[model samples]
Target chain A: DTAVSQTPKYLVTQMGNDKSIKCEQNLGHDTMYWYKQDSKKFLKIMFSYNNKELIINETVPNRFSPKSPDKAHLNLHINSLELGDSAVYFCASSPRTSGRAQETQYFGPGTRLLVL
Target chain B: DQQVKQNSPSLSVQEGRISILNCDYTNSMFDYFLWYKKYPAEGPTFLISISSIKDKNEDGRFTVFLNKSAKHLSLHIVPSQPGDSAVYFCAAPCGGNKLTFGGGTRVLVKP
Candidate 1:
């Protein structure tokens, strides 16, 4: 079984459309994260949920929001999408004992989102 | 500002040779450093890491060296293999909250 999985491996939509990316982990992790990789291949952390509580939120636009109904899931929802929102979004999870950034992070297959 | 930097956009090495990936940081407050290997269409996977207090750490064929003075660190793969070809990224925690990542360096292993 996949440790982490994301829905809609490839999502293409028009501008102003609302979309959501679902993520789930089976590692029984306590923490989940969302990261966006731009065309330049630079990755930036969007949000992190520790035990279903919001923790780290970078300077991402307010249009993006993360929700965790349970510790095993962290979904990303974007409203009124724009062209700049087109990028590959990755979902990852790790245990609280991962010892900061030193601990290994398990990532999903990544969702490629394209906003026309 | 980018706290971590991988100046080399890409690198190439022959199989059974040494692959040296360099990384530099501007924040001295970063006491811990990590190296992640990424394949296309996949998320970054942790390869190895070292603390500022230590000069080096090794795992199997992969070794991570930390030079605190230069604010630099490197990942070395001995006898590189074609399977080692991938993008390698460096990360460090300013404190304990989150990790700051570099632009990443693409490594190509020639057969």
Candidate 2:
């Protein structure tokens, strides 16, 4: 079974449209995160949820909001998607009690989004 | 400014040889560093890591060396195999949790 899984492995939409990407982790992790990898291959953290509560949020646009209904599920919703939203979005999770950052991170296959 | 950087875009090594990849960070608060290997169309996989307290950590053919004072870290692959060919990225966790990743370096292990 996949430790971390994401829906809509590939998504294509036009600007001004709305879309969402869903993610789940089966690893019993308390901390889950969403990252965006731009064309330059820089994976930047957008948001993190700990037990369904937002913990870390970078300077992401207000249109890009993340919602976590439960500990295992985190969904990202983009309003009026822009062309710059085209990139690979990855879902990752790790135990919140981890004392060390060296702990392994479980990542999903990633959802590729394209905005025209 | 970029906090974590992997200046070398690529490195090539013949099979059975040694391959070294370097990374540098500006944040001293980063107590742990990690290396991830990624293939085309797939998410990155954990390779290895080292804590600030340790100077080096090794596993099988892979080793991670961390110099806390210099805020530099490097990954060494001994007996490099073609299967090791992939994009290697170095990352550090800031504020105790959120990870910041480097741009990544492509490694090619020749057969």
Candidate 3:
């Protein structure tokens, strides 16, 4: 069974266009995260949510907005997409978000976005 | 600045050989560490982890070692097979549930 899954595995769009990526996790996790892997292959966390509440928000552009409908779903919406936004976006989740420093995070296959 | 750093960008090893990947961290407060492996067109999967209280943790052919004094961690894959080839990342939780990840080390196990 797929613990985590993201829609639109591959996305190609023109500059200034808007797009959205959807993610879902069926592991009964309480915390979810969104990560971006740039061209340099550096993976960085952009946003995180615990039980459908925003917890972590990195220095991401305002054009990018994340919405968590419930504990199992998180969606990313981008406005006026820029070329630099092209990268692989990954979704991850953990069972709980307390003092469990040793908790394991499950990741999705990733969505490859290309802004032309 | 990047708290976690993986110096080796890539490593190629022969089948049945051993592969070692290293990672360094700037903060000493990081007492827990994790290693993730990612294949092409796929997300990273949890491989192994090590806590500061222990020096080494082993799981089958994968072993992770931690050195608190040097603030370093390493992942060792013994008898690495071709299927073992993937990009490995070392990560540490900064605060709460946020994980600070290293750049990553790509391993190519040749058969």
Candidate 4:
């Protein structure tokens, strides 16, 4: 069984199209996160949610938004996608009991998106 | 500005040898360091981590060394095997629950 999973492992869309990526974790974690690994292979944190509460938002653009319906799932939606948005997006989860900032995070297989 | 940096984009090591990957950070507030290993199509897996209070932490064949004064940390893999070849990322918690990651370093173990 996968500890963390994402739907539509591959997504291809035209520029300006709207798209979404879904994530779920079965590890009973209270914190979830979204990361984008660009062509430079730098995995940058995009957003973080703890128990359905938004806790961290990086310098990402307004076109990207993250939603956490519950502790087990966090979804990312993009509007007016651009060529720069083409990258691998990953979902991660971690227990908040340990210091939320320093605890180990478990990541899901990335969703590779291609924007034409 | 990039807080965490992995200058080496790639590395090559022979089997049964030692592989050392280096990382540097500009943020002094980071008290914890971590390394994540990622295969071609899979997500990153937590490999090892070292707390600021300690200089070193070891698990199995992996060891993480932290030098607070130098603002540097490294991952050492002993007796490197083919299975150990993957992209390794250096990371640290930024302000809250989020982490700042360095550009990954790809390691290839030659048999």
Candidate 4, B2-110: lDDT as tens digits: 9999999999999999999999999898999899999999999999888899999999999999999999999999989999999999998877777889999999999
- Relative to the real complex, the DockQ score for model 3 comes to 0.78
Best by lDDT: 3
The segments of candidate 3 whose C-alpha lies over 4 angstroms from its true place after superposition are A97-102
Q: What TM-score goes with each of the models?
A: 0.96, 0.96, 0.97, 0.96
Best-first order by lDDT: 3, 4, 2, 1
The stretch of ten residues in a row with the least summed lDDT in candidate 3 chain B is B92-101
Which of the two, 1 or 3, has more DockQ?
Answer: 3
Residue B79: error of model 3 in Å?
1.1
Q: What tens-digit string does per-residue lDDT give for candidate 1 at A1-116?
A: 99999997999999999999999999999889998999998877889888999989989999999999999999999999999999999999978775454256778989999999
Per-residue CA lDDT of candidate 2, range B1-111, in tens? Answer: 678999999999999999999999998888888899999888888988888889999999999999888889999999899999999999887774688899999999989
Query: Candidate 2, after superposition: displacement of residue A77 in Å?
Result: 0.6
Output the worst ten-in-a-row residue range by lDDT, candidate 1 chain B: B91-100
Which residue pairs show collisions in model 4?
none
The 10 consecutive residues of candidate 4 chain A with the worst lDDT sum are A94-103
CAPRI band for model 2:
medium
Candidates 1 and 4 compared by lDDT, better number: 4
Give the local distance difference test score of model 3: 0.94
Deviation in Å, model 2, residue B80 alpha carbon: 0.7
Instruction: Name the candidate that leads on TM-score.
Output: 3
Residue-level lDDT of model 4, residues A1-116, one tens digit each, is: 89999988999999999999999999998989999999988898899999999998988999999999889999999999999999999999988775534368999999999999
lDDT of 3 by residue, A1-116 (tens): 79999998999999999999999999899889999999999989999999999999999999999999999999999999999999999999998745553367899999999999
Q: Report the lDDT tens digits of candidate 3 across residue range B1-111.
A: 899999999999999999999999999999899999999999999989888989999999999999999999999999899999999999998888888999999999999
